[model samples]
Target: MKLLIMSDSHGWADEVVQVVDRHKHEVDELIHCGDSELQVDSKELSGVKTVKGNCDFGADFPEEIKETYGSLTLYVTHGHHYNVKMTYVPLSYRAEEVGANLVCFGHSHVADCFMEQGVLFINPGSMRLPRKPKEQTYVICDITDTEVEVSFYERVSGEKLTDLSRTYSR
Candidate 1:
């Protein structure tokens, strides 16, 4: 299965819509890691799996989500509760408790991916106000029973960042 992951849109509805329309046909799942600032009834969020960030006010969205796809279990969160800006240790501990093989989170607005003690954690960065590398990024994760391949892409131009792409074996 392939999943499209993005976060921290911060009211950029047009970009979010563009991304959904661009990849809706190819990806099995679409995830927003929060700070979208869109209403629950908005068309942009129709089929998206989302969480609430610090900037999000309403309770319509959950703080975290746990979902199963094929044989993979995914845990999604906004990372503020766990203090992602300081360290991922807290979030990593939470993933262990949930028995998650994949953890998706955003809040730091820094795109990153890594594996720790058999669990994979990914942050797709902010599509609106990205920090660090500052490329307005998102992630495309291709998963199977034995491996996962992650490809990063630019939200505006839809260009892949091949240098940031990575594959991990299970």
Candidate 2:
């Protein structure tokens, strides 16, 4: 399965749409980790699954989502409730409770991907307000039964961050 994940666009609707349109054909699912700042019904989120961020107002969005794609169970969230900026332990525990093979979240606006205790955790960062390494990134995860290849990309330019891409044994 191939999954495209993005987050914290914070209202860069056009860029979000462009990124999705560009990669929709190659991915099996599209996910938005939130702070999109667009209405839940907005066209920008038409075919994407999203969770609510700290900045998101109203109750239209869910705090988290558990979804299955083939053999992979994904735990998706916006990360603020779990205090992601300080640590990922809470989120990891939640993923364990949900029996997830992967966890996707965004709130710190810093792109990152790593494996811990057999679970893969990914944060696509903020396309609009990226921090730290500041690459304005998103992630395309290609999964198989034995391994996962994570490819990070620049949302605006659609260029892959080759150096940041990695493959993990499952």
Candidate 3:
């Protein structure tokens, strides 16, 4: 499965929309970690999986969400409750509790992706208003039964920042 992960748009509907439109053909699902800052009924997010952020006031968004695509269990959240801006140890533990193969989150405006304990932890950062590493960034998680290939993308020109891929052993 190919999943396009995004976070922290903060209401840049055009930017977010453009990104999705650009990659919709290759990805099977779209997941938004949060901080959209747009109404729940916003057209830009019409067919995507989304969660709530600390800034998503009054929107009917859940604090966390779990969804299964094929055999992969995904856990998603905004990470404000876990103090994600500081540490991910607690968040990692929680992902294990939920048996999450991929834990997705946002809130720091920083992009990151890594694998630990056979699970993938991905933060797509903010598509707008980024604070670290780049002006805007996100990740595309391409997965299969034997491997997962994750690559970060810059909002400008859709360039790849880094490629982090892993293969599983039986």
Candidate 4:
């Protein structure tokens, strides 16, 4: 399965729509890790699974979500509740509780992906306000029985950042 993951748009609705439209046909699922600052019924978020972020005001959006795709299980959250800016320990425990093999979150606005305790954790960074590498970015994950290939992309240009691409054994 292929998944397009993005987060922390912080009100940049048009960019979100553009990114989704760019890869809609190639991906099996779309996920937004929150801080969208858009209403639950916003057209930009249509068909995208999303969670509530710290900046999100209403109760319409869920705090977290668990989804199963083929043989993979995904746990998605905004990460603030778990204190992800400091560490992944809390988030890791939650993922274990939910029986998820893939964890998707965004809080620090730093894109990264890694394997820990047999689980894969991904942070797609901020689409509007970026940090670290300073690139507004998102991620696309290609999953198979043996490994997962994660490719980062520039949010506005839809260009792949090959240097950040990684493949992890499952």
Q: Which numbered prediction scores highest in lDDT against the true structure?
A: 4
Error of 1 at 137 (Å): 0.4
Q: Kindly list the per-residue Cα lDDT of model 3 for residues 1-170, writing each as its tens digit.
A: 88899999997899889999989999999889999988889999988789999999998878899987778999999999888999998898899899898899999998877778878888888898888775588888888887777788888789887543333431
Name the regions of candidate 1 deviating beyond 4 angstroms: none
Residue 103, candidate 2: alpha-carbon lDDT: 96
Give one digit per residue, the lDDT tens place, for model 1 in 1-170: 99999999998898999998999999999999999998877888989998998888874899899997767999999999999999999999999999899999999999999999999999998999989567999999999878999998999899998877799997
Look at candidate 3 and tell me the lDDT of residue 148: 79
Estimate, for each residue in 76-95, the C-alpha lDDT of model 2 and write its tens digit.
99999999999999999999
Clashing pairs in 1: none
Residue-by-residue lDDT tens digits, candidate 4, 81-153: 9999898999999999999999999988999998999999999989999996699999999999999999999
Q: Given candidate 3, what's the lDDT at residue 92? A: 87
Estimate the TM-score of every prediction: 0.97, 0.97, 0.92, 0.97
**Which of the two, 3 or 4, has more TM-score?**
4
Model 3 TM-score (2 dp): 0.92
